[model samples]
Target: MVHLSHKFSTIPINFIPKQFSKHLPQQIPSQTTPPFIPFSQRQNQRSLLESQLISALNCCTSLTQIQQIHARILRKGFEQCCYVLTKLIRILTKMEIPMDSYAKLVFNQVENPNPFLCTALIRGYCLQGHVKESVFVYSEMRKKNVLPISFTFSALFKACGVVNDVDLGRQIHGQTILIGGFGFGFDLFVKNSLIEMYVKLGFLGCGRKVFDELPGRDLISWTELIVGYVKAGDMESAGELFSELPKKDMVAWTAMVTGYAQNAKPREALEFFERMLNEGVETDKVTLVGVISACAQLGAAKYVNWIRDTVENLGFSPTRCVVVGSALIHMYSKCGSVEDAYKAFKVMEEKNVFSYSSMIAGFAMHGYAYAALELFHEMVKIGIKPNKVTFIGVLTACSHSRMVEQGRQIFESMEEKFGISPGVDHYSCMVDLLGRAGCLEEALNLAETMPLEPNGGVWGALLGACRTYSNPDIAQIAANHLFELEPNAIGNYILLSNIYASAGQWNDVLMVRKMMRERGLRKNPGCSWLETKKGVIQEFFSGDMSHPRYGEMKQVLEDLLNRLKAIGYQPNMNSIAYDVSDEEERRILITHSEKLALAFGLLDINADFPIRIMKNIRMCEDCHSFLCAVSQITRRVIIVRDNLRFHHFHDGKCSCGNFW
Candidate 1:
């Protein structure tokens, strides 16, 4: 084997001058061949051998085959061939062979490793989660004065992100500027890698700084910082960056859409998607999922149908695309159409844990405990392991249906059978289950003794249960903890106040209100949205008689109240926490946002379509009973989606069976 001397090592690592190739010894031809072979023929034979070795390495699937090839290379006296060795190390990395176990040994045997060879090893170690080992290799390369390529820094930056070692990343960053000078420092690929690393490490400000300092930037650089801001929940900054981008691609558009959906600004997400389509940008499964999520949040049937059509037109079939199908199931479920969710689930060609969990949760949200339980078992029977979300859905089903014993059995089996340790959410579901079933004392004990600290959801559930059974004492206990845990949550104060009102403890209710005043916390106004037959969404607020059709809506409500009174139905005066007259209480109940939406639905929505209304807060007891009577008297189906769950009213009955 021949080796290059250190005297000529000052040349760039990537370039080996032609003058050096002429001095290398040539492989001897076989004895059967002519000993006087021409120089060009010997060169051709060597070139053919190198090509054949590369092709063989490409086809090598196992380590044994690679070892056999390595032996053949040594026998042919190509041990110092950097090109073939580089390819070999890459293949080993692709096969996920550990760096220290095999590839490092191959690297150690090389007498003069070039830039590519060193980079391949560095990348391999980084990929294998050996960041320190990769850095050590880089240090050795520097000691030998082998300059690194752009990919070397990229690989190191990505590894630092994987291990969350920002300090090491900064050191590598400094080396890029020092060793390679500003030319390499300003390399587009390296800059993008730095931005990605900082973004992934939650240093969005650092990523933005890099972006702002780039002398020349591409769409990739712009999009990296945009995505970084989106991940940090800074949609304002993301939008500003996007506005300044001269060339917008599908990835950038998708980032904004997904960011809005995740941040609960669903309307903005839909609007951005619409603009993306109008600008002639293409949509993919990811973009469609974001749009579907936004539509689900709106919970309007008109938007639901529009998104369904858009999904089909874009060639994303729910039956074929698993992610799109799973998203559709969730969207339909959230839009108050569990039947449609099941339909989408039924047509899917493949089912994973997400699809099953969405279906079970849909059934649970609609109070179909038996259906949720059945699907849960079916998913388990088909070898799909239920995750934490799946158990939450199951326990929620038990809570809604008051299946206390079944819920207890499932909760106990979570860790013992499925190896899924219950999280805080699962504990909250258990508390809600026991609390909803009139076991307030037991639920309180569980919340106090649970391994994890009780969050707002746990105490909130207990307080809600107290309202259900008119237990102000337990409600006070839950509210006290909630006040400390969530000082500014207006819902907690309201829930506690409602419990006091239900128990005729007006003084306690006044005290809660006083505390809210002191904290400058105002109750969120009751708001509802109803879609007209023309697909226009109308908004209504409690005690706000400002709609253009307020006259007709008032007349409709008056007529309904008169009919309800004829049937011996009386107004639930306790629904109002204020110490007002009977007439004032009746007026306030009639002016509730949901009631107004119901009147608008009756006037504008066709009888063939069920009246669907979405509310921002939970429906009051007075409104729930009123809707049940209206559904029976008018012979109509009404669906109301509040903060917690869906209520389907038909023929004087609610799907919740009066338990919600």
Candidate 2:
């Protein structure tokens, strides 16, 4: 019963192709082994005899050799020695060369059950993901009156961490304290494990308490605290403690880098990564993951190529390419380079669930619903197990494409077929689905019946639905909830005011405006940006006059409006509060942020190239209709990413099919 550490596979369970075994060696070793020492006089030959037998046993790591050894030992009648059995376990456990032949054979036959043998078996079970079996074996060992030593308890605790079972882990903690003293002044191992468990479980207070109790600690103890703080979402404290450490191991360095990235300080994460490299410390998968995650968050596309080059140059055989590829895809996607993302996604040798999740998200972000759906199908074709995050990406695609049937199919399949219960994010996707497709009632019903309490995102999605269909009733209910939950969020206030204005409820709109002013909240002005041929981006806000080309941009806008009007386009002023005069409505429409940005594109770029615009909020109904008319008149495609879906305007219509 030789126990080995866990080998983490990047691919998910079901997604690991049938060809997985090809990565392993074909030959396997047997569990039974023979003694090399001849049976003779007792004490005189013991030392030399044991050494020779151990040398012979060491060669039996393979199933073939072990079976031969077993036959020879049984013929010699020396197979009953417990010491011989323990040595066999060691050989079997460490047979990393090929088949897990030892593991298979040992569990099938053990003459006498020993604590050491049980520990070895438990380690194998934990590595193989038989978490419950690991716990069961430990409990059975206890019932048999075998009090596990320090090593056995540590291994059991590691199993608890893997499953993230807090209750089972707490039970393990109780057992440990019962065996040892509460005052960490005695030993560091117990305290360290306790702290790591508590931190991983989100009990930061308990982790700190355990750390404080430690009388004398090593660097490993300090590393555990840093890791705990990082995992607990307290990056500031993690940074402080990490900088103060006299000796920093690779684990501590990576932990601090990962913490910064997770807490939205990717720039700092990257800076520290460089400093750590400069310090000439060893790097591993955790270090690489932290760097890749930081790159993703910072939209640092330049780092992707550098990482690829470095991995190749250093000849590193990484099991983490899947995680890296996923991060690279997300980085390109966030940086608005769909081409780069698609290329990175295609080159991955082994695609995991996260790999698919990232690319699908990239496509959806860029408004490539068709491309997103195709990639998703390809993910399924390759046997990746789709999880909740994967479905979020898929549902988002259907939402953007306004594919009502496909969206509904995925939403239902989460629990009905996949056995995955919907969380808040899943419900949010559904709301976006029905909201974009104009099925307001169904979307509202789904939100109201959400298994978990509806959060601000869920309510906000429903409010977006109400705004889409001009349904004031659902809008009011959602608005009230959102205000109570997140009164400081600027978007909700704007949504409520816009809904009021859309329905010709001038008094309500004015009241909402007054409330915002009283609360010292102001609407975020509409703004947009365009990527120029020069590779620089120019930003424009509503009523902006700071650009050097503002005069020329305004002239181009006026001329375009005149041409659009000539081509039989009339402005829709319905979204304007009916309480306002008609002249004021026309003037207000001219001052839209998107219009200001589009005028600059018209003045600078050729008519043949499509004018792409990204906005911070959903386009008003009037603006959508107006953009359609402008597209028809100018004979140019207009692609706008508003707060909702992508609007591809051409031939006098939008890609949303009048849904958005």
For lDDT, the strongest prediction is 1
Highest-TM-score candidate: 1
Q: For candidate 1, what is the TM-score?
A: 0.80
lDDT of 1 by residue, 1-660 (tens): 222222223433223223323322334356686668799998997788888678767777887666656655665657788898899899999999888877888788798999999999999999999999999999999999999999999999999999999999999989988975647878999999999999999998888888888999999999999988888899999999999999999999999999999887888999999999999999898999999999998888888999999999889988888889889998999888899999999989999998899899999998899999999999999899999999999999999999999999999999999999999999999999998899999999999999999999999899888888889998999999999999988888877887887778888889987898789886577999977888888999999899999999999999999999999878777567555688888888999999999999999988998999989888888899999999999999999999899999999999877755
**What value does the lDDT take at residue 6 in candidate 1?**
26
Model 1, which residues run further than 4 Å from truth?
Answer: 1-93, 96-148, 159-182, 232-236, 265-267, 383-391, 408-423, 439-459, 469-486, 500-511, 558-590, 620-622, 625-635, 651-653, 657-660
| Local accuracy of candidate 2 as per-residue lDDT tens digits, 1-660 | 442111122222333223332322223334469345456644445444445455666755455565444443333334554455556656665664222445435443455567777777666666666778778878887887766656566667677777887788778877877767544234577667777777777777877787777777778778888887877678889888888888888888888888888876766887888888889877776777777777654333355566656555545433347766677677667655678888888877878899889989878866688888888888778778789888888988888777889888888988897788988888888888888778888888888887889899888888977877888888988899899999988778777777877798978888877777778885567777665645455677765577898788778777877887787767766444333588777766776788877877777778877787767666777788878887887788887877665677898988777665
RMSD of 1: 7.2
Model 2 gets an lDDT of: 0.71
- Per-model CA lDDT versus the true structure: 0.88, 0.71
The estimated TM-scores of all candidates read: 0.80, 0.64
10 residues in a row with least lDDT, candidate 2:
3-12
All-Cα superposition RMSD per candidate: 7.2, 9.5
What's the residue-level lDDT of 575 in candidate 2?
47
